[model samples]
Target: MERDILHLTVPTFPITLARIAEPSLRERPVAVAPLTSERAVIQCASLEARAEGVCEGVSVY
Candidate 1:
């Protein structure tokens, strides 16, 4: 018998949810990061944000 493996990703999941909750965020630059830390890292960034040079693992400062 053989088994198959699959991989899936939703890179902008956080931003998607945010936009769903707040329609005004659609088509806007959005990034998700920790709010409590002064040196927070970006966990996810929307396409608009990515185009502006924002990306995951980048500093939010």
Candidate 2:
């Protein structure tokens, strides 16, 4: 028997959702983080943000 599987993914889920909420952030360095905490980690980073060395798990402060 043979089985086939397909995998699909969004380029970047957090960034995609952010851009949907705020189109102006598109082309800008964007980081997905929780605003409820003063010391939250960056959950995701946009392409522009990564270019500047920003990444997931980075400190929000």
Candidate 3:
């Protein structure tokens, strides 16, 4: 029934898949950072950045 509404073969996976599952994140430049804390790192990035030779810990600055 729920599958019929979403037209998904496995609709549940998308919800808990990962931040990488966010459609808006696909093929876009993004990263996780800290504001005040001095110890943090990027958790994930989109396919676009990977294509551009970017990845976690590649400082944008």
Best-first order by lDDT: 1, 2, 3
| Collision pairs in model 3 | none
| Each prediction's whole-model lDDT (CA) | 0.92, 0.87, 0.51
Lowest summed lDDT over 10 consecutive residues: which window, candidate 2? 9-18
Top model number, lDDT: 1
TM-score of each: 0.79, 0.73, 0.36
Model 2 clashing residue pairs (backbone): none
Number of the top TM-score candidate: 1
Residue 25, candidate 1: alpha-carbon lDDT: 98
Candidate 1 residue runs with Cα over 4 Å from true position? 1-7
**What root-mean-square deviation over C-alphas does model 3 reach?**
9.0
Better of 1 and 2 by lDDT: 1
User: Residue-wise lDDT of candidate 1 within 1-61, one digit each (tens)?
Assistant: 9999999898888899999999999999999999998899999999899999987998866
- Cα RMSD (angstroms) for every candidate in the order listed: 2.1, 2.5, 9.0
Q: Please give, for residues 1-61, the per-residue lDDT of candidate 2 as tens digits.
A: 9999999976479788879998998899988888898799998888898999998998878
Which segments of candidate 3 are over 4 A away from where they belong?
1-27, 57-61
